[model samples]
Target: MPDHQYLLTLKHILDGLGRKGGLEDNLNGLLATMARELGYVRCFLAITDTEDEDLKLSLSYSPSKADSVSYAPGRGVVGQVFENGETVVVQRISDNPNFLNLAFGRTEEEMARLSFICTPIVSHSRGKPEVVGVLSADLVMLPKDELEGHRSFLEAVASAIAHQVAILQEELAVQKHLLNQGMAGLPEAQPPKNFVASSKAMRLVLRQARQVSPSRATVLLRGESGTGKELLAEAIHAGSPRAERPLIKLNCAALPAELVESELFGHQKGAFTGAYQNKRGLFEVAHQGTLFLDEIGELSLDAQAKVLRAIQEKEITRVGGEMPIAVDVRLICATHQPLEDRIAQGKFREDLYYRINVFPVFIPSLRERREDILPLAEFFLEEFSSEYDKHIRRISTPAIELLSMYHWPGNVRELQNCVERAVLVCEEEVIRTYHLPPTLQTAESSSTEISLSFGEAVGKFEQELLVDALKKSRGNMLQAARDLRVSYRIVNYKVKKYGIDVKRFVNSKSRKR
Candidate 1:
């Protein structure tokens, strides 16, 4: 190949890497481009297995062969290049005794006529260079004079591949670190307060939280019970400028209607039967800070009127006191009940609802963001493992499937309790399905017993079958269709109808690579 052609081939490979696809797809494209441009009869890309210290063939390109192969360190020319972190070139395979012919299994006569070049894909990490993989190709039709040029070209290609791999490795490392931090209850800018926001719904919630955090906006967090509204409120306070100040929390539903005003607006000395001294209310304590009022919908009508007056005036009069004391407080309110319905029933004041609902943030339930289930489970597992003094490493695959399939009606709080219980009952390093609550197991069985029309049942079965097939085929629709003994068109139509994201079935490791 000419110098210009070599440059073009390198450019093509780099361009493919920039495209939206997994590492394996880009690598296969690179191999095919090399073969088409340089006339290589066979090409192989192998990376070292860190655990086993062996070479595993990750990709292979050949016109007549589809076999995947591996090599032990120093077993063949490919292994030798990787082991030595240097390039190897054999002008004629017959002349080089080191050529093992392990990859292609070419006969001795065929091998004698072939020219081979193998180069180490080396990367610099922490100011030290390390061989990450081997890139090798065989030239069966090129002249001897072109052998040196091709060897240099292969070395250049190896350098490009090494650069791409290093970038991907760095990204994977960052993801692993972030996941660890989340599981360990560390804060991150993207998700906020160790919350898992992998699903689009949760991410939108995070974005809103971040946007509203810097201001003094009164945020009303709306979500079902156990949807982590308190966590979200804390996240907002933590992100706010007044984060250093105290964040006073009160549950209106937990307090009696008679004491609500005293709990919120403070009490003068001898103001009530239980009051022996002057007592500061949450509003006064949270001055220049934040006050998180949970179950706001449960506030009594008189309490609501007083709360509304305090919010509007930015001042509160102590219970049984005539004078009002000024306060500067950021308010965050949460309620699972619909305040509008409460207003219709004349249980809640509309004015107070609008006052607290100025900046509403709706947190989706766990069942709504199903994609986040596994991450949240892992996070809870880590927390519970530490709490129980156990060395739980992971959740078993069957347990994961069970957790994912179940509808979490009680949301994150429920998940946290379930994981804690599992950790207490678990005996081994892994959390198995048996360790989970009986309710989870019964959930799956209950799902199957639901009443449905024949058409609905068949559609459900078809969707499940297609999903299983796609998972088995690693998101390859054509392969999934073939596995199901159906036409590709039908499979594609059903995939769209069922709103499936085929890419989700693809191996996440492949994308990270």
Candidate 2:
């Protein structure tokens, strides 16, 4: 029962399918046939949708009973399949407590005696490894002699089922094909030039985003206001195969309750007052692309339901239109508030939070990544200076020092505005300390909360921040140094002064100052 031998036999059977009942029907019939032949009591085939909205259970055949039931992806064995892209083979399904039983009227003990095996079907269409759906087959009350043969047989049968599923979708003539191209571990393209992130905090976010970009998972972007959630959404969309297509952005909080639904789900002509013509909303416009729903934490419970349905069903019903319009769009959502807390308070739906938060990326506030403050200030100064027709060389060292010391609660957006305002009014080529906002100079002079000496306080804070960055970077010494905006020698000196193990943080992955 080697894998290679089994595969050859499978190819022969596929060649034979051309002459059977019908191409498509023969395929399904053979799938079930192989299931029973493999000494299984029943078989089930669940296929994940193109848009990855949810898994559609297509076949369920149980030999013991004549009846079969279809269940949702998150409801039964398929739920486990959707959650983890691995085979769930149970020799005794009833014995396992984690086995969320879907086998009708079967006790845990009874199910345990009946060996179970489930394989996740990774569709070639997406070209990414994921639990697209599952194929479940089991043997009832095996006495050990038949168990070995049954297990081997089911694996071969599972492979056959996967091929058939792919072919079926191909034959269906899907107008919008889900592109299979992308870095299996990275984005399809580099990040935006304007979307700057040299700091470790932002780098970590980028890393997480890339890791989940290729998979069929809903992305939940959590951050404070003006923390570049929309920018991150754009990065995700741009780095996807759908990059060439439209990126539909919806400010969920910007629209009123009366119009939010219509703005997102579209409405027919005369669906409501001011519906002068049939207007497609953000969702419809971004078809075959990405839909970034900003401020999702603000969505009403009723609005939350519609959004969840659109994600779960891969189809949306317009405000007035009864017929469901199937959409092929990847969803990337962003929110400025803590959605989990909101869910607890009942302001946001728990179900929607879970649905959208398949992969969550947290954008760190500017205060957390203070290393980027000076660079960001300079970049903005250059941008605004050029726009305003000024020849601003750069900020003076004292001015940059002042800018760096300020705790920007308003984050990068605030820094950009500050730099712009300063550049517009400044006279000299070198932006001086006086040109900076008064708050910055005040913060630089007396922002120190600790009563320790000037050097002592800075030393203590820098050492602690560097250590935290090292831990977050998984002991990458170079990354830690770069994150702290310090030289390698300075980081090494601190390591020795603090008696910290230098070898522990050895993986260097960043440039020196």
Candidate 3:
């Protein structure tokens, strides 16, 4: 038997779970609502890791206070409830030996004075109820006799959470099945193909992408055109929890201004002149997945406003519809255009810029990460060779030098096109400089005294000197530094500064042996 306040809190949580948002949002809402209403000092939800079956702290009211704690099944009170699928109530947490108190960082005195309650969150699996997680709370002032009542109330909340999880899981399964069946207009939710990141700069970018992938953080990728911003977005999606769902991509600059809103937020039947039937928007299609917007700086101010609202509210209103539809999407935006300049010129909304800029990943241009150029070129050569049915065994040294010397203005995409063209033109076993585009040859010759500041010129010279030293020493940093007459520390600093990956040279030297 639950009290009036407990029932009201349970109802609020159950109702909040139905509104459109991410599972994390709904779970946080439940925790916050319950904590506020029940006077809980702390509340936490721990879900069993799919791979390891260990209890992972998924959500907490005081997130910073919650450490990255994990528990084996039946290890702690929370774990016991999850493993045994039972309710646990400790009148005083310190008296219970099973209470590990791993996350809260509470003192023994504080633990002894507080009451603890944990409930198992169970969901149906193959028509059988299975425990999926544990919901636990800390109460500072609740009487010992009231522990049973609080336990019952928490059981209700856990049930509500389990129900939501079941719904989301079912939806995800259906979406995956539909995608596998090759549903029309839906992008395949395939993992991103392996991308090369041999350069330190590119590796750092990949690290950042991996770090932010697990969380539902809005990522803004800033880079020059053809720098693989879209590729990085796909990698983020592949590494995310929503990898099984659709990853819808749209080039904002490619769409006409009149259709931007309609494309993003679908219109109802007869909503406009061309509204032939009710259609789902990209947001809806990308639910539980990712929406990658390339050239986002091209969005109109009106469109930016609408997008901002959708991001803020996790809901969207169709172009002509008044009702708001819930959307659960991880937004990954990319742009070659300078958003700050657009904001200064009133072409982009400042608020929207700030919102999307939560996790900004700057991808270095090909010129900046020159060490990756040869690897990327080789990769492209192999890919194009396979595609064109050519047995181009290797790129000639002269051709490699030419590829390295020419400043790739169009970056990776330009390099890929160049390699494809070279593959198509070359008739022999190897690709030579002659097989390369005439523009590259002319560009290399004409750019002898390339316009560069004194510092840039010195840096380039240092990088070239370091590369030559590393080559002479067969990628031995200590030997290279000794050959260059510099300390190992200085050489190491210079290598990192130039975004050089010494491992590639080291492996090359090893392969020679």
Candidate 4:
């Protein structure tokens, strides 16, 4: 407490505040000041992790290795403070539940916990305080009574660190925003627009896609629903050597069991009640090209045997026909259902599974490729903007953050739909949080599905979509009309039907000029 000593401590505190590196790097000098001021073994600062959702070491201090310490939060006294979210003051280590009288490791101590305490770090986000991290420390260096003072000082210091961390996060979010803008600015791919994918996992899938696209070998694409299995099929057929040849696709699961055979292999005239003509099957039309069978797992056993024969022999027998018809076509199939499990259940054929699964590729779900979320969102913005003919720019920072945290159970497909909906409904120069679908606006608070009467849900959906077009049109009843894929008169009619307050969303020109 002497003037000269206090002056030196003040000098170090000022220096510690400006150090720009890890939490420990900035706090080390302060810990030294605390040690010198209190005549104790060490002073430490600990930060909790946003990950373990528990306090982990952000920084610490001690007599010998105070400059470098390691103790995972929830491990000892430090961990106890984190787990309980309370301060500790154990003058004797042997007497307390938290006491590890036999301390070994970094603390490696017979050192008593004369006084230890911790506090949560609540940081500011958008002017709102959030507990982004936690703070803790040991007052092994301070007087027993000033434990209260140490607590106060720790609280202030944690707040300061929290503020800095919040500011850094905001800046990062902004930089990411600009980077995404750059990515979105790239020219669109040639055709089949908006199949958004950019990540190591997806990149590898594209690799396999390229390899199988050129050959007549059967390709089986597998993944949970919404992982873009159909997109892969389309890409394969579009890029194959048979690009000029017809590429036919059929959804086996969507057809009735009685209709699947005629649907895939075609039928002779009057083969069945609905079969009035000699229709050409996918295999025949896709000769020298590709045939994609989606939800192939749903094929009946009889259908499976025929499909297997077609794949094996490169020929097909029309329904009610005796002779086989030769065809050369690449086969690509996909299913969300587990084929192995189905095979075990006798719902799928084991032999047929091996044929189409010759070159198997699994598309990872969205959560696994989280890094691609924003990228995909931005891609959809441009795609939908062009489709809707809106000269839109970007999405707001808050909206983008909301998107990043969203759990897209429906994967990229869901994201595409959300963004397209946002684009069509957004009236602002840049898409704001409000432009996002109700599912997103409500997602932050609840994970439950949005339920409504079928009619009500459809009405709400139609309203948001039309509102987006009105925004893009800038009140030019004509432009808004074109953007919605409806005639000007029809748009005007729906504008009334949806009860959109057109005046509220029109751009300046639409409003005044």
- The numbered model that scores best in TM-score is 1
Query: Candidate 1: which stretches are off by over 4 Å?
Result: 1-192, 444-513
Between candidates 3 and 4, name the one with more favorable TM-score. Answer: 3
CA lDDT of every candidate: 0.80, 0.70, 0.81, 0.68
Candidate 3 residue 349 Cα shift, in angstroms, is 0.4
- Model 3 per-residue lDDT tens digits across residues 163-266: 56544444344444445545423333232443766565776687577567767899999999999998899988887778888999999999999898888988
Instruction: Supply the TM-score for candidate 1.
Output: 0.54
Candidate 4 local lDDT, 168-269, one digit each (tens): 333334334435545333221122565655565776676566555656678889898898888888777776667778878898989999889987888998
**Per-residue accuracy of model 2 over 8-90 as CA lDDT, tens digit each:** 55665566575534446765665566554444567767666646546655556665443344445655555766667666656
**lDDT of prediction 1:** 0.80
TM-score of 3: 0.52
| Residue 467 shift from truth in candidate 2, angstroms | 36
Better of 2 and 4 by lDDT: 2
Cα distance off (Å), candidate 3, residue 280: 1.1
For every candidate, C-alpha RMSD to the true structure in Å: 18.0, 19.4, 20.7, 16.4
Give stretches of model 4 more than 4 Å off. 1-193, 443-513
Candidate 1 C-alpha error for residue 95, in Å: 39
At residue 210, candidate 4 shows an lDDT of 57
Instruction: After superposing candidate 2 on the true structure, give the runs of residues whose Cα lies further than 4 Å from its correct spot.
Output: 1-189, 444-513
For model 1, the run of ten residues with the poorest summed lDDT? 181-190
- By TM-score, is 1 or 3 better? 1
lDDT of 1 by residue, 52-125 (tens): 67777767898657456767888878778878888887888887887877666787787777888889888874
